[model samples]
Target: MPITPVKSTKLYHLIVEQLKQLIQSGEYRPGDKLPPERELAQRLRVSRAPVREALVALELLDVVEGRVGDGWFVKRAPDSSLDVSSVEGRPPSDILQARVLVECAIAEQVAAHHDDELVVGLHQAVEAFADELRRGQLNGEADRSFHLLLARASGNAVFADLVAYLWDLQNGQFFRLVEGMTGNERPRLERYVREHRAVYEAVETGDAGRARDAMRIHLEGVAKDLLDS
Candidate 1:
């Protein structure tokens, strides 16, 4: 069996696990409304953001149901532990694999469907990248913003959210690891701008084939570099 690396616990994920245990242990039964966010935050001694994120995550897991203007209620108990520690400790290789799968598909979708808002968003992202790059202050955020715009341009909320989450993971963990290995950022910044612009131009021209191809090549190159590093 392959070894799984030990992971740091995320505050929100810990909140999620604790709440799940409470429900599974019969402290919170099905149909039992959970306390207000403030109450849970106070009880857990954590900020409200973790509580809110945990609730959203729980709803996704179908362990809790949220009723409008009412509150969250225990919907069902988890049959097994809901561990999100892997997400916190996700390796760069895993993140790149996901990006190549999802972002490449999104590139085609964005090119097929033309929306004024999406076009503008893409342009704005490109501009942001360029500005940041020139300022010598660019980091992973500029690159992440560009890809996120493409994900949003796909007009799929689920895909967009997934892309955003992947970027957060990449920026928080993978990028920092890369930066440590490559202390000088200037070379990477130039290459990132060029690749981002290539993707934007392909999408702007409504060339689905080129857009898909460009995204695949760029992400594949990124995967290669990270793996080789």
Candidate 2:
């Protein structure tokens, strides 16, 4: 028998490949729940990070579904006629618009119903975002965290999970494309810092309308930049 060569790739990608193969081979059927992340990681003899990332990738492909408070399950077979990944491949501007709609509403909800505990968490998220900015980090995790924290403060797990799903969709390819098109990234990052602070302050003060406006304006600006750049 001839030997096949493996190409170098990220560990998460390799995990995704194996999981996809499992789905394709019918070892896992539609609606079948997969092993827990830690169990998968232990079985595969790898870190849980790669397993979690792979599950996210699979979910994007619509081959799996992640239900809140429940484990991940196979949603569909790879050979299904549905092209869910194409839906996932919508333009970045479209995603940003959807984000603006959801997140702006979340900002309103948080401002309306915030307590001392939620306010404290929001403050911590804001400080974390600022610290990342001061360090000139472009990884975007802290920025995403700030937004995710706001969604969580909305008292809705679905909103927080949706925000995470959107962030996952903005992968390396998205960043590379944005970087190639935009030249004013530094100023834009600075602007994001300010806008985030504005949103936080509005929510902290219990100004619902102001919080909604702040979030809406920030996302609208992002949509414009991404579209017009």
User: Which prediction has the highest TM-score against the true structure?
Assistant: 1
Q: Summarize candidate 1's per-residue lDDT along 142-225 as a digit string, tens digits.
A: 778788778877878889888887777766665455667556657766777788788888888888889889998898888777
Worst 10 residues of 1 by lDDT: 80-89
lDDT of 2 by residue, 100-171 (tens): 888999999999987889899888888887788788777778888899889988989999987777666654
Clashing pairs in 2: none
Which stretches in model 1 have alpha-carbon errors above 4 Å?
1-17, 24-27, 33-86
lDDT of 2 at 216: 93
User: Candidate 2: misplaced stretches above 4 Å?
Assistant: 1-88, 171-173, 181-183
Every candidate's lDDT: 0.81, 0.83
Q: By lDDT, who's the top model here?
A: 2
lDDT of 2: 0.83
